[model samples]
Target chain A: DAGVTQSPTHLIKTRGQHVTLRCSPISGHKSVSWYQQVLGQGPQFIFQYYEKEERGRGNFPDRFSARQFPNYSSELNVNALLLGDSALYLCASSLVSGDGYTFGSGTRLTVV
Target chain B: AQKVTQAQTEISVVEKEDVTLDCVYETRDTTYYLFWYKQPPSGELVFLIRRNSFDEQNEISGRYSWNFQKSTSSFNFTITASQVVDSAVYFCALSAPIYNQGGKLIFGQGTELSVKP
Candidate 1:
């Protein structure tokens, strides 16, 4: 079985630019979530989508948004990225929300 | 609101030795779940184990063990006979159990384990 897959393994953008990270969950999975992992730190939840609806959000600002497709895939978009946005973006999927999240390799985003 | 704290930032153990990583969490909700994940240098988060709020019993899974204590809101993981492959960052996470509502996780700072031969 293919695990959660993330696109654009690495990316570089200038401040104020926008970036979108993609994720395809494991087959037969319905829940997808986004997280941000700063250097030397654990992941911080960004958003959770189940059945195409936004189920939860984190302490992040309005610049961060996400959507879940009918196939349980997901996209994480960051508008006007800041230098602090330089981190790894991770996507996780599971049969149920808020449990055993099988994570992707993560997209490493660098905002200069 | 929920918060998790991992006091140890890093630990080193010789191969074939035993090591324990500590985790403490705080939440207002009575029902929630705790989890442990391992992230190696490859940057993939690997799910290790999960413990629900009511299940405080200690669990032993081969070389991995988890001790859940509700009285102290602590969930600790121990690796016996540690191997070099166990060198990674271990994270402790918490999530609310309510459905229909989006349950986001709150994770600890993580403990980086280094196993040497």
Candidate 2:
């Protein structure tokens, strides 16, 4: 079976610019969550969507937003990007609230 | 706010040696979930294990084992007979009760493991 998939494995953007990352969950999965991983750090949760609705959000600022489409694919949008926004963006999918999660390889974003 | 601490920033051990990664968590809520994930050089996050608050049983899976201690608020992972393939960054994470505010996950800084031949 296919695992979580993300698009544009690498990206580059400039300050004040906007970027959008994409993710497609594994087949039959209903929950999708986004995470940011800086160099030498663990992945930090950004947003989680379940059943096509927002279920959770992390400590990220309002400049970061995400939405899940009817097909269960997800997009994470960052506005006015800062150098600090450069990191690996990960997408994870799980079956339910307490089940194990499967993560995508992630999009490596570099904002100059 | 919930937080997880992994004091061991980096660890190195010869192949076949044993090593343990420590994780300490702080949360005011009584019910929570803990997890450990491994990220290999390929940058894919792999789920190692997950432990709920009520389950304190130590679990052993092949060469990987988890020691969950509620007293110290810690969930440590130990690898026996480590291999070069075991080199990766390990992350400890916490998830609040599903009904608490929102089911967000709080993560630790992570520990980088290097296994040598």
Candidate 3:
């Protein structure tokens, strides 16, 4: 049985550039949420998608957006990246119950 | 609005010692859920436990235990006979009513635990 999976374990981008992070939830899971973990801090909510529709969004700027595909995979896109955007991006998926969330190892983004 | 606070920024204890991580949460929803996660240096959040607001019982699982107090709005985690393997960042999180909010998880700043052998 596979857990949640994320792609490009590490990434580097220049300021004002754009980046896309990918995540594939476990089979049979429909809810996927994204989080950003800055160094020395906890993971902050970004966006959540369930059944191909966005159900919630965090306080991030419009430069950050995400969408869930029909297959339940998700992509988090950040535009005009800044140095502050460098962090570990995490993806979590859960069953309909939604409380028991399983998180991926996360993609470490470094914007210079 | 939902928020979680972990006052202890860092804690150090010798192996076999006992330690407790405190978590304070604020939420308006009458019923919600609390969770504990352990993240090692490798940087992955490992789920530890989950408790709903309706259940205030203290739970024990081997060397780990949790105390949930609704009156105090606290969900505390204690590790007994701690080991070096416990060295990591522990996070306390809160989730609003799952169905209504799509299970947005609000996390605390996290407490870094250092278990010296």
Model 2 agreement with the true structure over B29-89: per-residue lDDT tens digits: 8888899999988888888888989999999999999999999999999999999999999
Q: For model 3, what is the error of residue B51's alpha carbon versus the real structure, in angstroms, after optimal superposition? A: 0.3
Candidate 1 Cα deviation (angstroms), residue B47: 0.4
Winner by DockQ between candidate 3 and candidate 2: 3
Each model's chain A TM-score: 0.97, 0.97, 0.97
Report the lDDT tens digits of candidate 2 across residue range A7-92. Answer: 98999999999999999999988889899999988778888888888888887999999999998999999999999999999998
Candidate 2 residue pairs in clash (backbone atoms < 3 Å): none
After superposition, candidate 1 runs with Cα above 4 Å error? B99-101
Error of 1 at B91 (Å): 0.4
Worst 10 residues of 2 chain B by lDDT: B96-105
Q: Which residue pairs show backbone clashes in model 1?
A: A55-B102
lDDT of 1 by residue, A1-112 (tens): 8999999999999999999999999998899999999999989888898888888888799999899988889999999999999999999998877657889999999999
Q: Which stretches of candidate 3 lie over 4 Å from their true place?
A: none
| Residue-wise C-alpha lDDT for candidate 1, range B1-117, written one tens digit per residue | 689999999999999999999999999888898999999999999988888898888999999999999989999999999999999999999986655246777899999999998
Off by over 4 Å in 2: none
Better of 1 and 2 by TM-score: 1
- Give the range where candidate 1 chain A is weakest over 10 consecutive residues by summed lDDT: A93-102
Please state the CAPRI-style docking class of candidate 2: medium
lDDT at residue A83 of model 2 (Cα atoms)? 99
